[model samples]
Target chain A: DAGVTQSPTHLIKTRGQQVTLRCSPKSGHDTVSWYQQALGQGPQFIFQYYEEEERQRGNFPDRFSGHQFPNYSSELNVNALLLGDSALYLCASSTELAAGELFFGEGSRLTVL
Target chain B: AQSVAQPEDQVNVAEGNPLTVKCTYSVSGNPYLFWYVQYPNRGLQFLLKYITGDNLVKGSYGFEAEFNKSQTSFHLKKPSALVSDSALYFCAVSPTLAGGNTGKLIFGQGTTLQVKP
Candidate 1:
């Protein structure tokens, strides 16, 4: 089965600009979560989407938002990007039955200039 | 708030030697602990988890973690290390909500393991 997949594997944006990263969950999975991994650090939870709505969120600001479609794909949008926004954006998928165990995609490397 | 801590930034071991990466967690209620490995340019890969079972949990790539409730620690261990095992290891914890698991994970800073042959 195909694992989690993310788009725009690598991209660059300037300050005050906006960017959107896409994710397709693993086959047969319905939940999608986004994480940010800064240099030399582990991933920080951004938010999680289930049933086409954001069910859980982390410490991120309003500038960061996400959407889950009926097909279980997800998109993470960052508005007014800052230099600190530069990091690896990882997308993970899991089912309600297997909640804690996540399958991650290679991640999209976002570089803010 | 839930959190995870990986005490070591880097660990070096001989290829044939055993290895241990320490992790400690803090949570309000029952904590669902997990271990994940990440290679260069790759996402975190699930290793093992500690749920409501035996203290010892085995996972992919011969990785095993021992959950100590009293100590609030989950340390990943391998009987023998391999050069291929060199990568970044992360410890994460999810709090158990009254309804169910929120599927949210709090991750540690990560520990780099170097297995030299």
Candidate 2:
């Protein structure tokens, strides 16, 4: 089965610009969660999308938003990007919303200049 | 809030020697702990998790982690480390929410494991 997949393996954006990163959950999975991993740091939870609605969110600002489609694919949108927004965006998929093992994609590397 | 701490920023070990990456967690109720490995420019790969039952859980790549409830620590171990075992290791904890289990993970700063030849 195909694992989690993410688009725009690498992306470059300017400050004040908006960027969207896409993700397709693993086969047979429905829940999608986004995470941000900064250099030399572990990933920080961004938010989770279930049933086409945001179910859980982390401490991120309003600039960070996400959407889940009926097909279980997800998109993470970052508005007014800052230089500090440069990081690896990881998308994880799980079979359920409860405690379960997560399968991750290769991730989209966002470089905000 | 749930959190994890990786005490060592880096760990050096020779090939053929056993390796251990330390991790400690803080959370209320039953803590669901996990270990993930990340290669350069890659996503985090699930190694193992400790939900309940056996304290020792074995995972892919011959990796094993011991869950110590008393110490609130889960250390990853490998018996004969290889050069390819070098990678960034992260420990995470899933907080049991009052609403329900969200499976949201709180990760540590991460530790770099350098297995030398």
- Among all candidates shown, the one with the greatest lDDT: 1
Candidate 2's docking class is medium
lDDT of 2 by residue, A5-85 (tens): 999999999999999999999989999999999888889999998889998899999999999999999999999999999
Candidate 1 TM-score to native: 0.98
> Residue B8 in candidate 2 has what lDDT?
100
DockQ-based CAPRI category assigned to the predicted complex of candidate 1: high
lDDT score, candidate 2, position A68: 96
Judged by TM-score, which candidate is best?
Answer: 1
lDDT of all predictions: 0.94, 0.92
RMSD of 1: 0.7
**Which parts of model 2 have CA positions greater than 4 angstroms off?**
none
Question: By summed lDDT, which 10 consecutive residues of candidate 2 chain B come out lowest?
Answer: B94-103
Looking at the true structure's interface, with contacts defined as alpha carbon pairs within 8 Å between chains A and B, what fraction does model 2 recover? 0.76
**TM-score against native, each model:** 0.98, 0.96
User: Which pairs clash in the backbone of model 1?
Assistant: none
Local accuracy of candidate 2 as per-residue lDDT tens digits, B9-114: 9999999999999999988988788999999877889999888999999999999999999999999999999999999999999887676666899999999999
What is every candidate's C-alpha DockQ against the true complex, given to 2 decimals?
Answer: 0.90, 0.74
